[model samples]
Target: MESQQEIKVIKSSGKRAKFSLTKLRSSLKRCGADDHMIDKIVNSVRDELYQGISTKEIYNRAYAMLKKEKHVYASKYKLKKAIYELGPTGFPFEKFVSTILNYSGYKVVLDQQVEGKCVTHEIDVVATKNEKQILVECKFHSEEGRNCDVKIPLYIHSRFQDILLQSTAEETKPQECWVVTNTRFTKDALQYGSCVGLYLLSWDYPINDGLKDRIDRLGLYPITVLSLLSNREKQFLLSRNVVPCRQLIGDQFYLDHLGVSQERQEKIMTEINLLANL
Candidate 1:
C-alpha cells in the first residue's frame, strides 16, 4: 500500500490523485485482460512509477507493454482516454455515433434539419434500421467528471415529441429516441430516461450494453486512440474529418497531405495495422 505522499498521478481533468496499483490493475481487468497479462503489465508500470507522473504517461507505458503482449487488449485499454480525445466540440463524437449506428445495421443521416410540428430542429443523427427509425442526440463532454444530466433528457424528449407529432405515419415508422454520451448519465437523467422510455447510451450505463461495450463488440475504435499520435496530431486529424485509423491504413496521399513526416507516418501506419489487425 503506497501512501499518497509516495506517488501522485495528474488526471486528464488536471487534478491530482494518489496513484494506486490496485486501481490500475482493476482497470486492466475491466478491459478484458487475462490474469497473466495483467500481472505482467501491472508489474511493468509499477517498476516505472514516479511521483507527479501524468496519468497519460502511466497509461502509455502500460499500453506499450500490453501491446507487445496482446494488441487487441492494448487497444481496448485506451478506450476511456480515446473517447475524451474525441472532442473539444461534439462533432467528432457525432461522427463516431454515426459510425457505430452504421455498423449496427442502421442507415444514418448526420446533422440534418428535420421539421418538427412547431419548428425545424437540427437533429444530430437519424438512424433507420429495417422498419424502426431512431432519432439520436449525442451529448459529448470533453472532461471526465461531467455527465449528461436530467435537463438534457427533458429537452430531447420535448424535441422527440415535437418530431413525432409533425412527421407523417410513414416517416415516423416504429420511431424511437436515443441520447448517447461518452460519459455516464446523472442519476436523475437515467431515471428520467427510464420513465420516458428514451434510450440512453453512456460510457458505462446499462451494464454490459453501454457505449464502450457497443464499440468494443464491433471493435470500432475512433482514430484518436492511435498511441503513436500526439494530442495535437490527433486533433488535427479529427479537424480534417479523418476520424478513423482505418481511413489512413493504405492512404499514403492523405498522410502526406497532413504533412506527417515519412518516418512518423510509417510508425503510425504500423501502429494502426497492429490495432486494426490490417
Candidate 2:
C-alpha cells in the first residue's frame, strides 16, 4: 500500500489533501473495472503519483490508462465530464433529471406549467409516483466550484407557496417542491432546504443516494461518455436530447442520424453492452 502522507493532491475546490490510494482504486472499480484491471491500473497510477498534482490531471492519467485496457470502462469513468457536457443550457440536464425520475418509477413531465395563484409557473420537471407528486427545479452548472445558493431554494419556495395557494383554492393536493442540481448546494442552501422541508439532490450530497450515486446504481450513463464517440458526435446526439447510452442498444436509425458509420456503430454498441453489463 502506498503511504498516503507521501503525496498531496489539489482538489477541484483548490484545497490540498493527502492522496488516497483506496479512493483511486474504488473510483475505477465503481466504473466496472475488474479486480485485476483495478490492481494493474492502480499500480500504474501510483507510480505517476506525486505531490502538488491536480485531481484533474490524476483523473486524466487514469482515464488514459483505462482506455488502453477497455474503452467501455474508460467512457464510464468520465461521468463528471459527461454530465457537464450536457449543456451550457440546463434543458438537457432537466431531461436527464426526468430520465432518472422515470427510472425510479415516476411519471415525469418536463418544462411543465402549473397555475399558481398569482401566475403560471413553468417547472423544470414534475414527477409523480404512487400518491405523491413533486415539482423539481433543476440547476445545472457546466463548471465546477459553482454551487446552488440559498436564494434558489428561497425563490423556489415562494413559487411553491403560490402554487399551493392555487391548489388549495381548487381543493387539490399540493405538490412537494424539490431542488435538484447537477453540482451541489451551498451550506446555507442545504440548511435552508432542510429547515423548510425542501428536498435537494446534488452531485455528491445525500451521501450514498445522491444524483451520481443514483446514476451509477442504475448504470444509466449518458451516451456522451462513450470514448469512441467524438465530442462533435456526442453533441450531435445531445442536440436531439438523446442522453442515455442504453437507448442506442438497438437503435441503428438514430445511430445513422448521429452520423456514426457502420464500423463505428458496432464499436459503440459493444461498449454500450459492456457498460450495461457492468
Candidate 3:
C-alpha cells in the first residue's frame, strides 16, 4: 500500500496542490460562484482529508460532498472539479468546439442522437450559420505519440452519414462536414475526405487561436458569436437611411442595382409592369 502521509501532504502543498486549487478556483469563478462560497468549499474539502487518499479519490469525494450542500455554488464547484480531475483533453474537447463554432457566428446543438435500423450515432456538435449547416466531430488526443488509425475516420463518417440521411428533406443539407481533431489527421484520411469534398479541420489551423484564447478568458463555457462579428458587418446592417426593399421596388435606382442579378432583374421588371396600373 502507498504511504498515506506523503500523499496527504503532497495533496495539500506546493505546485501540484496549487495547480489543482487554482483550477478549482478558476472554474468556480467562471461559473458565478462568489469568492466567499469558493473559499468555504476549498476550506471544507481541505479539512476533510486523510492520509494515503489518492488525488483522484479526493476530487470525487470533494465533488460528492459539495453536491450534498444543495447550493448553486456546489453545482458550479462540482462541474469545475470534474473537469480538472478529468484533464481538459479528450471528452472536454467538445467545450472548445462549441466555443469556436459560437465565435464563428453559429448556434450549436449538442449531442444529438440519430437512429438507424441497426445502429444509433451521436453527433458531438451541429452548428448553423446563415443558411449553412455544418457537422463537427471533435477528437482530442495527446500531442505526442497519438495514433488516429481507424477510429477517428470511422466516427467521422458514421456521424456524417447519419446526419445526412436523417435530416428532413426540406431542411438544408449540411453544406460542409468537418472532422475537427486535436491531432492531425492521417494522410490517408485527409486525402479521402478531400476527394469527397469533406473538410478536415485540424488543430493546426488558425481557428485554434480564437478557440484557445476565448476559452482561457471565458473558461470552458459556451459563448455567443453575434457579439464577435466585425464592426463593418454590424454597421452595414444598421444604417437607418437604407430604405426597406419593399418600399424601393418601383425606384429606378433600386431597379438598376437589382438588375445586377438576372433572376432578380426579371422578377423586379415583372413586378414593375404589374404595379404600373396601380
Q: What is the C-alpha lDDT of each candidate?
A: 0.83, 0.85, 0.51
Error of 1 at 115 (Å): 1.3
Best by TM-score: 2
State which candidate, 1 or 2, has the greater TM-score.
2
Worst 10 residues of 2 by lDDT: 166-175
How far in Å is the alpha carbon of 212 misplaced in model 1? 1.3
What TM-score do all the candidates reach, one by one? 0.81, 0.92, 0.41
Winner by TM-score between candidate 3 and candidate 2: 2
Instruction: Give the clash count for model 2.
Output: 0
Q: Give the winner by TM-score: 1 or 3.
A: 1
lDDT of 1 by residue, 1-278 (tens): 35444888888668789998888888899666889988988777877777778898988888888778765567678888788888888999999889889988999999988888999989999899887889899999987768788999999999988888888777564379999999888899999999999999999888989987887677677888776667777777788887767777755667787688999888777767655545
Question: Candidate 1 at residue 190, lDDT?
Answer: 97
Identify the runs in model 2 with alpha carbons over 4 angstroms from their true place. Answer: 1-3, 169-171
Which residue pairs in candidate 3 have backbone atoms (N, alpha carbon, C) closer than 3 angstroms, thus clashing? Answer: 4-52
* Candidate 3's TM-score: 0.41
Model 2: per-residue Cα lDDT over 123-227, one tens digit each: 999888876888999999988767899999999999998889788543255558989998889899999999999999998889999987998888788887899
Looking at candidate 1, the ten consecutive residues that score lowest on lDDT are 269-278
